[model samples]
Target: MHPIALAILLTPLGLLLRLYAILPQGKPTKRGVRLVSEPCKLGMFLGSGGHTTEALTLLSSLDFARYSPRTYIVSCGDTLSAKKAVALESLKASEILAYSVITIPRARRVHQSLLTTPLTSMQSLATCVYHITLSPLITGVHFADVLLLNGPGTCVIVCIAVYINRFLGLHSPKLVYVESFARVRRLSLSGKILRFFVDRFVVQWPELAAADSKAEYRGWLV
Candidate 1:
């Protein structure tokens, strides 16, 4: 290689090597990165019976084992799918179960669960959890509660939960939430406002339109 070209190439490499050497080996990893790369987590879903389907689909399709995740379906729908009912059991015994068929027979509504279940019990079981919410949920008052009661948005809540774990003298845990793709023709001011807050400040692309932010285009799903 030409001397000039060689120097140019070596210069960047030298600087990177120097940086690696200078950064202390004992220097703590960022709380965020540590949590995901080697997580001790409990996955929690925060939606109705519909979310149960999405979570199962995600588990079956995604690289969930990478996170070494475990899940708990917070029954917040009217109908709970705890175990197969007699009809489903009969179908299963006959070897007629559909691959897409789920056997749980109970469903939960979100408000009812939140109002009735013990947050303390859940917190004890999970260090961190993934919360999944659907779009239709934004129309209800529960939407406001999630934004405010949880941690502004899903990502933030998870991140905050990690910090909370730290404060409680526990190791960081991974937090993940599944939100739907955006396709809203008409949005309420509150909905738009919630989206803007998320858009102006988040690591990933905003899933909704925001006047103050440009949306990022993720390539088509293969």
Candidate 2:
């Protein structure tokens, strides 16, 4: 069987493992509660193009002191997002806090042949697993205290990885999913999937929020 097919077939096992980790004996960590009183690590997913712009704009409204040790995740080959993240880091530099940027394989390579999509998707999944598990080992941080994400294909994979991580009792980051301003009428595909798992689901339009009672109307983010 193809590797992608194998991965897909094993997804049910992964879900079962996740459920096992969440059972009464698992002792899952609580969400939204800070593990420590000190400033915590913040992980932000920066997608290319419009997604990057909207994420940076939302960053401007956040209090840096509360979300220090910020780590920006950018898609590989997305130089624009990397450059913007670096610029934001420079502007927010402080002796007491730190900012870093990391790159991961994009879920879909630009202009990739349709026949190669499954392989690329598997590659993306491997990248997500590495960054979620091993990356933290190297960085000395188990996980981000809060993971802020917006609409993007990459965001969906990362959020799933986060959920899996939490299920394994590795970490419990408060996921905040914000729908892009462009999504005024309905949640984007990424937003819709993340809404079911994220701690907070926010929409820029009142109509979108009204349609999904679980989602909060946070006005325009960009």
Candidate 3:
């Protein structure tokens, strides 16, 4: 094998190792936190319908002024979610130009064939990567300081895109995953998969939290 080829192959492994080294280890803890003097760049994925409702409910409790310059990523064709986001910002009275809604291809559509899902999923990741990295340059919204995600298939793609950001040495966002309020006894598929990746894994039910060592019970955050 050529030396150049070997180096190329080894480079990705090195990057992966670097990313893994920075990931939070073991169970998560509740800690005191101070509010940032400067407004944080917030990123959130609205999965549409119920997911959107739960996520917005959680955001309603936050001081929008403190988490200014929000980026709401919605699935393609999800105008409702985008509208809801705008409505929420209006209610919060955030700065007029404080938020942007970006649409990315969905990982899988309803009734999408299993065989074709991977192709669409890849497309979703590609779009996500483009938006996460290049959109900032065009729109002036740098990669989010904090990314909040809740259940549904598309959120997983966003998580992977964030991982890719870290692998490429970009300043990755702090990933926070909130399990759905409806998931009481067990972790949802998205929650189970994201548990290992997210910086914070929150479950609304105590039993769900107890079942997963990494999950934190936050008492129904929707």
Q: 1-222 in candidate 1: lDDT tens per residue?
A: 999999999989976675454332332323433434553323434233444344444444433324333334333232343332223234334343321221111222235455534453344224323222222134321111111111212223333433333344333333333333223333333233333322222112233434324233242211
Q: What TM-score should be assigned to candidate 1?
A: 0.35
- Tens-digit lDDT track of model 2 for 1-222: 999999999999988877665533322235445555578778899988998989988887777887887888888889999899877766766666478787778877768787987787667777877777666767866668888999688788788777667776676567888888899887888988877777778899999988986788866778
For candidate 1, give the lDDT of residue 120: 35
Question: What C-alpha RMSD separates each model from the true structure?
Answer: 17.4, 5.6, 2.7
What's the TM-score of every candidate structure? Answer: 0.35, 0.81, 0.88
Cα lDDT for residue 111, model 1? 53
TM-score of 3: 0.88
Write the candidate numbers in order of decreasing TM-score: 3, 2, 1
Per-residue lDDT over 38-83 for candidate 3, one digit per residue giving the tens place of the 0 to 100 score: 7788999999999999999999998888887889999999999999
Provide the lDDT at 19 for model 2. Answer: 69
Name model 2 segments beyond 4 Å from true. Answer: 1-37, 137-140
Q: Give the clash total for candidate 3.
A: 0
Winner by TM-score: 3
- Model 3 lDDT at residue 27: 53
* Backbone N/Cα/C clashes per model: 15, 0, 0
Task: Give the candidates in order of lDDT, highest first.
Answer: 3, 2, 1
